[model samples]
Target chain A: MPRTSRAVKLAALPDGLPGPEHFSVVDVPVPVPADGEVLVRNRYFQVFPSLRTLIGGGVKGTPFPPLRPGDTLFGAAVGEVVAAPGVAGLRPGDLVRHWLGWREHAVMPAGQCAPLDGTLPDPAAHLGQAGVAYTALARDARVRPGDTVFVSGGGGGVGSLAGQIARLLGADRVVGSTGSPDKAARLVSELGYDAAVVRGGRPIAEQLAEAAPGGIDVLVDNVGGEQLQAAITAARPGARFVLVGTLAGQLAPDRSGTTAPVEIDTFQLIAKRIEMRGFGGLDDAGPRPEWTERVGAWLRSGDLTFPHVRVAGIEHAPRALQELIGGRHLGAVIVEL
Target chain B: MPRTSRAVKLAALPDGLPGPEHFSVVDVPVPVPADGEVLVRNRYFQVFPSLRTLIGGGVKGTPFPPLRPGDTLFGAAVGEVVAAPGVAGLRPGDLVRHWLGWREHAVMPAGQCAPLDGTLPDPAAHLGQAGVAYTALARDARVRPGDTVFVSGGGGGVGSLAGQIARLLGADRVVGSTGSPDKAARLVSELGYDAAVVRGGRPIAEQLAEAAPGGIDVLVDNVGGEQLQAAITAARPGARFVLVGTLAGQLAPDRSGTTAPVEIDTFQLIAKRIEMRGFGGLDDAGPRPEWTERVGAWLRSGDLTFPHVRVAGIEHAPRALQELIGGRHLGAVIVEL
Candidate 1:
């Protein structure tokens, strides 16, 4: 058995767009499981846009504790349990999902790990495409049949899956917005989006109005700021908006305070009776197991496909995350250990 | 019975604050009820802040049609059915609530009228205090017992009632915001608010933070713009925000688009997982009858009291509406026709 492991650690709290310098990949002794704990050998981990919020100055009074210097960067990962100590649900070689990523080996409490149903050929796909997107759509947005759904950052991993999930949920029309026209075209052609709107160069509202002339019934928003504002404008009366990410500002290189803060005109929320909700990983925690079962069934039935960007080697995780945050990656960025 | 009836008509759309000059009082032949219709002699009409939205150049594709030149400004009214033509549920003397106000007499379809339970001595109170506010708090906000509730524009018609209703619904603490210190004191002393934050001079967020430092579980927002922004800042994780009015912008004298649009940092929405929804009269249409019944029961039991400003004579309605929009009058503004 390997007696050493490698993990990414936060070297410093980032003030703005984080760079590779803020993270350090270092070798450490392999963790051993204690009583009622499991030692998992990570197969794959996710590098998502939300990592920006975690590394950027922490949200004031955030419910989840902010990552500090010297702490291992944590995220959802799929792995095989190499060792288990008096744990009822797990045995060595069992596949599980746990929040102990950016690492090769992790020692976690057995109860915190979820056993995968083995329906997906590559179970690591659950870390991104099938996880947050599924829970947010099913529990938060509650996408209904015949809903005219719009997704922001639709070319990204979760957004791409969100389009498919909306279709599965019986959405009549699914429109996705991406940063470039090429990606927009790809989203519609390959990702099952009914239509795609290019996000930049003009006010998102004007572009969205032109695309969704009638109005959006449900908005799965990954890019906040102006994109969200545009979705609000394009929303029909009684539309539902779910906040999934704030990638619009995640890629900005200039972290200067002088930049005018991106603003959203909330008047539309009142005038049109729009319902908006923000969701995070913790919010999806309770419903995740149910969503996982459903997603597994869909995967087994060939009803779903996940688009992802895989990077070989655990040493490349910092760069992979940077690529995601920099908007260089179009789909979920996965690190293969 | 008089053969003629007088009504207030919109003279022209105002660019800014509307005055009596924008309305014209004229006499017209009393409308005769046809089959399945009733001729109502309006006893009392409401002049609410939302009227500004109706007359202010229309809210784009507003469901409530913009009041045009020579068009009767419609609103909720409590009146006596003077004549009913084959209406099964109505009698000539029965009091009813309907959206046919700003007039001395209105001919309305029988199906549109909502019969008041006749529990209160002055059923005209049904138009303002006991109408939309109760319905919105119960249905839209979904105020649960032990919730920490906050009401913006708490001294106004809907805000005042929202405070009491939150308390009646078993809220642990009810905090309210008012534009003036006197009204702030009144809200805490006269109304059932646990505390009152005066909104002016300093940023409202500062005052609200000081008032409800722990954070609000539910926000019943009446004044939009900065008040809504401030509430969003002060909301707790998973807080429920119900948008009831945009009187904050309505009260602003400058109607120029140059004025910085009221901005809400929606990043906070995602960070805290806030749930926000806009509430309008139409939003309450489904639950109103049941809410009215519940309110009538509360009123009969002396468990509820409605504070309102009653202006005598139909001639005073236009000015009364201006007062409500201009933030001069406290509580619900009603005109006795």
Candidate 2:
């Protein structure tokens, strides 16, 4: 029997900021499990800023197809397996997390679904935000104990979790920057961050310098542009600047009109031997199986944690995305059915 | 018998461009060499732009000594061994190069003297300009075969030799930028440069783009300021921007009472994986012994070549330095006595 479910679809492409009008709710017949597939009823969907880039047409140089009008919004999700076709081990009613989508139910390849153990304090923890955030913080940045780390956009889902994970990794000082003072205080008080700065008012360099007087060793930047520029200035010699977002704006324009000016004191790099790297969560999945294990272990051990999400029903996903785009949410925003 | 020699002494420190008034000729008795020491009759002295920094008092970061009223002007020079005290393998009258001074005679440790082999075409070749220029080209930039290389200030001693050496390294295309059209033509026709552009009037990026349509793979930057900015704009993905000099100026002051704005798009580095390195020939010498051997082999094999220098007498070194500081000379300027 074919199952039916409600899914969020892109109604129109956003210009700069995505609004509720850009997305529409639609009822669709649920997919059936094929010979090597499992049918899952999705309980949680991950909403992220990168998804904004998808809704705003698409990002250049990305390997995936762009979202056109009336296309289903897709991402990683946690669900319960209701049926399996020739798939052993994962029986009916088994909880799993897979790269499912905004729909209520999905038929994914059995290989895609990983059984979510009951060890996690919450089932929603392993599916989206916590999973990717923990993996990026551990592997890519290679956060070590006694290292001073700066997480930009630190009040957001990934940044919030990354702060705690850095603390768990034995970071001596964890500094975070956000647009809201409330978020800043929450990060410092509740999320184990040593310091947090509210962005947009003062020069970030002065604030960062005051926050980490010894200097910042690792920068997990989720906000590029002016913040990145400030980070380069405040960075200790040999500091590793990681580029994970361009929330400020992508193309930095200069006097040359067409060409963007990207300047660093070349002497600083030579003196410090700094290394800068960029990575994305979607690309983190295939090549690195260790990421899944690490995140799973961290969740099981309670070394890393995230705030409870404000779940909206499937029809209210557009409203949730709007809240995210408006920077009205404190933590991860997920849609549930 | 002790040899009496006339050496150029620093008379005064200059506020900007150094003149003959800043230097004074002084008569001093040359000291006798002890064990492991050799006395050399200074023949040739090098006059480079770096001397300007040494004369303008001193720079904070670099190791150049501040000029005192009566201190001897120190620089690289080629001379002939006049006496050897308890030193083996070198005889009186053997030509050698040492970091002596603007003096007629200098007695120093034997280790400072590197014997010049006659197997190389010119004796002056191992002196100041040729040796340092060739070393900078081969080691610092790591010029490779079939690479499109661009050099700024190409008519100058280091830039001229760097262009030819890049060709010898099997560079598919060697382009250069100079201050004058005559120098540009000379670089293309006389030297081994594939193309040369007259600087000063237009942006370097436009000129470089026209000269090397494929884009620059390695940039041997001698001129900074706007040239550095333009090169960064014109640089291809994965290009290596090597900062070798900053003749234009360092630290351009913004007059707006605002912060000095330097935009660095992390995306530029991420998209191209570009590597920016800064090198001083002085720093390159200690770590890499292979640099000396490579340049020596190239010199002996006739694969790399540089122009004969316009020799000034030892007494005329101060004038030659003034000329160099005023940007009058094309190729390397050396003082011979």
TM-scores of chain A, one for each prediction: 0.91, 0.86
lDDT of 2 at B49: 64
Please give the DockQ score of every candidate, comma-separated.
0.50, 0.18
lDDT of 1 by residue, A1-337 (tens): 8899999999987777777888999999999899999999999888876676666655555465556789888888999999998999788999888889999999988888888776566787768566677777777878888888998989897898899888998889999888887888888888899888886677778888877889899988888777777777688888888887777766666651111135544455677888888875533355346767777777778788778888999888888887887667677888888
- Clash number for candidate 2: 1
Interface RMSD of each: 3.4, 6.0
Model 2 misplacement above 4 A: A1-176, A180-182, A186-198, A214-244, A250-263, A267-301, A304-337, B1-147, B152-171, B225-236, B250-263, B280-288, B307-337
**What is the fnat score of candidate 1?**
0.54
- By lDDT, the best candidate is 1
Worst 10 residues of 2 chain A by lDDT: A251-260
Recovered fraction of real interface contacts per model:
0.54, 0.24
